[model samples]
Target chain A: MTAPVDDPATDERLLSAFLSGDTQAFEVLVLRYRSPLYNLLLRSVRDPQTASDLLQEVFLRVIKRADKFHGSAKFSTWIFTIARNLTIDHARRMQHRRHRSLDVPLGAKEGDAPSANGTLVDRVVGTDVVGERAVDSQEIQRRVAAAVELLPTEQREVFLMRQLQGLAFQDIADVVGVPVNTVKSRMRYALERLQAALADFEDHLEGTR
Target chain B: MSTCEQHQDNLLEFILDELPSAERRALSDHLSECEVCPAVAQRLRRGLALAATLPIEEPPASDTKAIMRAARERSGDASTSVTASTSMLPFAMTGRWGRVRAFLVRPQVVMATVMLLAVAFGAWYVPRRAELGQPPAATMTQPLVVASSGVSAPEEAPAGPDGGEDSAAGGAAQPAPAPPDTAARLERGLQAYGRSDYVAAIDELNAVVSAPDADEVAWTSAMHHLARSYQQNGDCASATRRYEQLFRRSPSYNRSNQAMLEAGTCYRTLGNEARARELLEVAAQDPATREAAQTELQLLGEPPRARRPARQPASRSGAPTAPTPSQRPRHSDAPY
Candidate 1:
């Protein structure tokens, strides 16, 4: 998406402006990051509403202590670090409460509520929805999302940063609080597991068409 | 480690196009012939490409606006500690990026942004207004000295330094030539107001304001000084009306925000707390007029709130159910 800001100020500069009492700088920061932040959170939380709340919480914290910005890590890494922690925290809380079986399947909400495992694929390729190609494309997307959601949390986080967020391994390591080598190992494991999980659907790749 | 084992760890980097040139060439050569590594690389590429296809959901649009609104309300009191309840900040925060969390969620950014937009809008609106209100060059610099008791308020007196020490010990110390027409009428009114002659100043400013051929700049200048005349004359009702008109029609008018602040103060003094709160709240939003507005509000004490209607609890049966009030001191290790 095209950013709304002009002058192309660095995040640090924009944040500095926020600290010194330029409120618009902070708005620009919010507009710039809202989408990506939402996606990152939503991709993990698997619920749009919950993800938006997490995104708000992330920036809410940012807004509170706006006077100071960490000088070391880049802003994206720093923000994603916060997001990662919140998502993990929420996930752990839900997990402990549910104590559901692992076989509950990927993409299932952690409640007695109806399973989303079937809804994801069905919503994508439901009957009378669209063309065959569109259905296949949506099918692949649903399948990929499920595969991603199924990865181990550490591996999933590394993969999300690398593929979805486009963070370099070093930066991902910084966000996840791991050594660079550990991050690389996790990314490799993530890819390997995703490939293994979705191997049956590889022939359905949409981009090649 | 075998040739494949050594290059195995490099595959993720290679797929990312992040491998150094030498390592890339080595990986490429090895992958070209190594059966296991070649398939591994293909799967890696396919897996990443598949992951890329997962849709980027557009978050609900209201999310940011809601957060910004919350930020503004939470941060409105600058003196309140922002991080007073950050029990929700994640991680140990022992070192790297520890300090960044505070700023990440502060409301001041949005507050500052609102101020910036207001200033920008004011900046854009003022020149347009000036273009709209253009008058002859001769009449533009006409000044009206505020009755400041010998303290010069240049903002009230745009006139060139004319002549004479302020005659009164407590008069505003501004001098200007005695001229005729709109400028003269405005000057006469100002002189009267400065001399504490409210009745004559009101009559003179009223005639000048009602004049058919008044210059646009002179009209604005007249209305502004007329409000001052009314305020000094202790006619706060008329003063507030004039100030509110100027505030709505031409917020860029000199001391327009000041007018609002003053109007709010006047209304508050006259036992109209609601109007005072409204005007003071708006004035407090502007950086230039913030201190004045906030000071007035502090003086006004807490604004009265409307009483909420009593809520009846819903019961499936036709019996009345008393609602439980959860009002209590909250203790938690999490930030809301």
Candidate 2:
């Protein structure tokens, strides 16, 4: 578990330290959050290369707007809001470049087994199940990614942050500018859809395998 | 069978791993009793773990490096220029001068400049006496508002008194007797304040403050009321100075703490945040002033509530003491 601050709570302590010329605090914040934030961006843009460019934009916007972080909201909430805006901007740019629809299903093929639509268990099971297990892993990652990509934008954001990245419901609510209960409800529906997509696997785990 | 909605909803936090230990334990207890919740929880948890493994490819290293480098460069450039300017000008006097220049460039400057000119003109225009070879202005009014004793009988009024205009009105009309009920007059003054007529309230309160028979209670109340009237009228600088005077003159007044609080509020509202914060620090330290000071401090978002006064260092040496937000009294959020 991430430990709460062991040091005294100084208002603007981190920002003030950064402003007074210590850059390492900025780096610590970056390293602490970069992975989850980058993943969120990657899923939104659906292009790793574009997500990388957009991640830089998000951070650039953060530094540019750091002075505006008045402690009114949690720092991470503010950071994610910036990331959210950057993703929207990236999506718009891609749209202008002839991305006909923002919500294109991923890895949907004619012969893809209905029961083979991947889910989270497959991802975990696929991880340890190697070479011979490789095809199942790819299939699961694809179906799971497709199901997630098909989520309405708002629900998708809440789902990614809550279920995938493990953000607290309150934190996701703050990031998405929704009520906490709304975040919980969105996660519930997202989980329900994933469960249904993988119902066969659930039966198989209970039955033969 | 328990509804999937109810089962999944209860497992939501566990699916996300945000469930506190107590809640997790409770959930475990419930799971043994209710089969549906555990099944849903297990399914959701497995799904989430897989979702977590979804390749969140590292945003390219170049972009990360570029953004961080740009941020550092921008921060460095700004800091260097500031440091250079401050070092070259000693004590950041250059910064102050720049602010003053900006202030003087506004339209209000002309009005202020003219008011200064008028005051300068009055200094010479309202002279005590004309020179021996020169004539005074054809008509001169007597020095205004000198001592006026209680309503004098007409017989005591001097007839055709010297060149003073106010000297004649005094003679013609036996001045009316000073109002008998000073408390009634004070009542009227309080009513004026309720009506938002600060000027009338202040005039009446000033009369009460200066009354020859003004008692300690009346005098102190009148002064506090007058200062509050000035503050309500948006004359913060005047109100603050008046409260400062009141504090020194009547430190033992029953309402001394109230005056101190008003002075601090005036400074805070007038954009003299440093002075306001200093006064708040003093107020926060004094038990008499603590509650009001706490309220104001909370409004300013000074968190962790009150901190204990730190023990003074034995040797006056250590890593630079991190200034307590209260001690430093930074009103960074205060508008200029």
Candidate 3:
């Protein structure tokens, strides 16, 4: 019988079982973390295909490196660290590819104001999610997602780990390799930024509430 | 810390239900009395409520199945089910052509056949050439071209220091035609790099760089990626070597200065400060690389060659000038 999926202790045991040749344990672990990790990757890269590929890669790495899990850290922390590193690498590669494109001037700075073409969030938030006919809840979700995307990468990641994955501040610090205070500071900044960006949505938020 | 400051630190913990009860109560009491704190807490709570609206998505069931299959395969239980073997028997026994097709589809069989043909051709062709008193064919020096990803290919003809010396040393011999999949291999390497599988990236990029007939453009790009893969894998020594080779081989490459800066940084990590300084000095001469190179130099305790006006005012405490890793110039100018 499978253990409870939500327990951190169960996660560690699943990993141990996987390392000891029980492939089903690994599957249980994958199912447990799939939604959270996929959500993190999707909001991060803003592409469903890339997120799916990254999700598979994360599990593949866990499978390959199962022996490296020493149990000192929570399994979630280790898995998320791997996921975070891959996303960072994906961002770097995308940035590099953009810079390499012939049409983009070499001197164009990183973090330049989004082109008049708009940000990925603007491009991806379809009429279904943000249209006038959409419900207040959907509109609020669309606005919140767009705002989260607009935050700087550091803040956005911290916010997602806390708000989406419900990672403890200390666990987030371990994953991000920063101090607990630093994680909290980033989380605070992220919330403040989200608040400011969605200020105009106060009426919508209140209506939904 | 001020009462407000102390309470502010606990604000997130309080909302997230992570704070100890005593501290949570203390912050709650303070928030009721503190005008600014309540608003801030309200805003944070509002942000959290709004963010909670973003729906949790289920990944495709196919991806979950694939992950499980991969895990099972890697754990060596991939063959536990005999269905695949039984299913292939009908196709294998269909006809002579079916058997041949099945044989050809086995990678090991195809590879062995290719090797046998090459060996037979070489034995017959080389002796014929010697009998006619003609020079040996240039193919003698060419590395065996493996059609696969080359991850497990023998490294008999290792890439030279600059990744081009072997080809250059071939002198008057006509360059071999690059295998048709050079671009494909390079792309795979880059994809692996993007996935943070640096070891796989190194393998694929190394194969691209070592190809006897890789064009100048592909070879240079492969060398740069190979170096980065090594660097990302924490093999600083190999990374530095590849970076220096890239810098020396193609000084005119658009990103040579960036490579030099990276090589210098790697050297610093490897404790060869003198070499690091040498390369960094050269990198600092390029406008594109100057700031990062100078920052690395500063970290190495070397004074700046010239202080361009600070982009922002120097901090009052004169904190270390090196940019955080995120702020550092990363492939922003790479030619890719």
* Residue-by-residue lDDT tens digits, candidate 1, B1-336: 467757877887898888999999999998888767776777778777677777667777677666665455445556543432342222214254646655554689768878899999989877876786755342344333232212222322311111121222233334432234655676676566544355777887787777776554455555766776676444678987877766775666545565676677668645577898898898779775676567557645633322111111111111111100110001111221
lDDT of 1 at B130: 78
Q: Model 1, A31-147: lDDT tens per residue? A: 777777777777677777788778878887777755556556577677777787777566544533433333343366455466645443333223242334444666667767766
Error of 1 at B50 (Å): 0.3
TM-score of every candidate:
0.48, 0.43, 0.52
Pairs of residues clashing in candidate 3:
none
Q: Tens digits of per-residue lDDT for model 2 on A38-115?
A: 777776666676677666666665665666676766676666777776665455344334432221222444344444
True contacts kept of each: 0.29, 0.23, 0.38
**DockQ, all models:** 0.12, 0.10, 0.24
In lDDT terms, which candidate is top? 3
Question: How much native contact recovery, as a fraction, does model 3 achieve?
Answer: 0.38
iRMS for model 3? Answer: 11.3
lDDT of 2 by residue, B1-336 (tens): 234344445577765566778877777677788645665566566556445435445556665566556557546777543233222211223368867755764669978998999998877765734343333542221111011221111121111101022233242243223344454455455545534456777787778767777555445555666776687555677778778767777787544654565566677545455676777676767675566565554434433212211111000011111111111111122111
The candidate with the higher lDDT, 2 or 3, is 3
